[model samples]
Target: MIHEIAPHVLDNQFKIQDPKPNDYCLVYNGSKSLLKKEGNGYALPTVAEIQKLGFEDFEGHYLLNIDERAFFLLAVAEDYAAPEGYEFTGNRAFRPMAPVERLGGATAAHIAHWEALNKFCGKCGNVTIRGEKERSIICPKCGNVVYPRISPVVIIAVRNGDKLLMAHNIDNPNPMLFLISGFVEVGESLEQAAHREVMEEAGVKIKNLKYFGSQPWPFSDSLIAGWTAELDGDDTIHMQAEELSEALWVKREDIPPYATDVSISCCLIENFRTGFTLPET
Candidate 1:
């Protein structure tokens, strides 16, 4: 849903181009992004703008463009002091902005993480450089190439006649419940991952699994595949204490709305609450 910015095209094709002064600059310090304070919130700073504030030669790696406007992921220092009228905010801050900016911030964040994590070659312990022909990094010593990683995840809504399974993970800061979801492990299909995740976390089997939809979850560096399934056996939830803080079946009417619908997990839960049926899937 976050990437559904209609009429705002994203040109992700990699090209060799240096950042211009007016082009948008994306800078991050770990999990927080550096942005100039806008009217009520914040906006991305440009190369010229950051340079004017004493960050000289403020160039960055060229990322994709949105609607012909270019974006560069800037290399920033570790110790950050926000200039007047500027601040660094977490990823959630991008959610409330207009769709175009929202997508920009999230996409930039994803690339930033990829760039930060893969500073050297896995095959050879040599410093890597950006690949010119693609969105990847290359090690000169070994000629090893590394592309941005996109991990696959599965999110499923398991339903009985009148109730839907819900869970609050142990690591989640917000206590709001979510559908059964987890990363797809090695040697597993999306379907197998779905089944295993449900059983491991909720101690239940599922039937009538149907493809719901998918979303690019940039916040977690995951591409979430959504699914809908029916409970196969008992309704009693033998919750996995190590994985979840709470897991239970909530009646359709009792399932509360999630704070945002920008995720596939939220869509799965909302579909169950609305009594959706599988269309011959």
Candidate 2:
């Protein structure tokens, strides 16, 4: 839902250029991002802000653009001083950020993470170079190329009669229960992933897998495909203790409401509860 920046379009066509004065400067350091302090909130800084940090001719890595505004990643030094009114904050602060800014920040963070992981070539162990014509990393020695990683994930809402299935993942710190979800494996389809995830996580067979929608979840470098399915065989819970803290069925009226409807999983849950999901076929 964070990508729903209506009226403002994301122009992701690659362009090899340095940041201009008005372009956004997306700077990341470890788990934190440098954001311009805007009164009580934060915002992406302009190239001019980074210029004030003593890098007058800063050459930045070009990221995508929002509307007509370009964003660039600035690789700052270890002791990079924050421009006055700009602060470094943990990336978690992105959720409450304004929708447009949130999308930009999250996307930039995803690229930063990918860039960090691909510093060396997996094929020849050579230091990689950023591709000028596309969003990719290239190894100079062995010519190995790595694109930005986007793992496909399926988030399924399994319905049994009037009840919905939900589970608590062992990894999530939040106690909120979510729909059955997992990453698609090699040589797997989205539908296959949904069926396998439902059975593995909740120990239930499901049918009538209907396509819902999709969202680019930059948080985990995942493109989540939303799905709705009917509970097929058993309704018993054979919880996978290693991955799930809990899994169970809940009546429509009993499904816990989410604090914020800002994710694909949240959208799927809301649709099921409101009876807006695809009709049974």
Candidate 3:
């Protein structure tokens, strides 16, 4: 959903291009992004402004090429202070902005996290360098290559007649309800993960597993594959106390308000509420 930027293209080719003055520069300190407040909103700085602020020494990666201009992600030192009239905010705050801005901010944050975690080779203790032909870091000594880490997760909406299953994650500080979701474990297919997550979290077996869709959730470097499944046996929910605080089924009229179009979880719930069926796979 967030990655579905129509009209505007996102080119992720690993080309060694210099930053132009007008190109967008995403400056990050730790996990927070720098944004200059403009009237009632915020805006990212240009390459020229970033250079003027003495952050030009930091190495930046080519994040995206959109509308003939490139976007670069720069990881600044934690001690770096924001210029006057600018403030640092977490990536979540960027979601309410325009589509291009929201996508750019998320992409920049993900790239920054990847770059910070892979400064040195995991196999050898030597420092790693960016790959010339691909989006990866290479180790000279051990020859180990590291790419951006994306953990695959399955988010499923369990259906039983006119009711949809939902749960509140115990680990989340926010009380927003969500569908059953979990990371895809080793040696498991997407469908298998979907079934396992539902059973683990809600203690229910699911049938008629249908592939819904997917979304690139950059908040924690996750690619969420969405699915819809029917209750196999019992309708009673045995909530996993460790993972979920509560679990319940809700009809279309009683479903709670949730996420925007930026997430596949929202799409899944909306589809079920509208009685829309996915095309045969």
Clashing pairs for model 3 are none
Write down the TM-score of every candidate. 0.91, 0.89, 0.92
Q: Candidate 1, residue 86: CA error in Å?
A: 2.9
Better of 1 and 2 by TM-score: 1
Question: Model 1, range 1-281, lDDT digits (tens) per residue?
Answer: 77777788988888977778887887877657888888888788887887787868665778878887788887666687778888877777677777877788788888888888878888988999888788988999999888888999999988888988999999887778998899999999999999999999999999988888888988888899999888997877888999999988889999877644377777777777777676772
Q: Which ten residues in a row have the lowest lDDT in candidate 2?
A: 255-264
Q: Tens digit of lDDT per residue, candidate 2, span 33-97?
A: 79878777787788887788776888778888887888888766547766678788766667778
Native-to-model Cα distance after best TM-score fit, residue 196 in candidate 1, in Å = 0.8
Better of 1 and 3 by lDDT: 3
Q: Which stretches of candidate 2 lie over 4 Å from their true place?
A: 36-41, 77-90, 256-261, 279-281
Over the stretch 63-157, how does candidate 3's per-residue lDDT look in tens digits? 77876778898877889888898898877766777788778778878887788788899988899988988888899889999999999999999
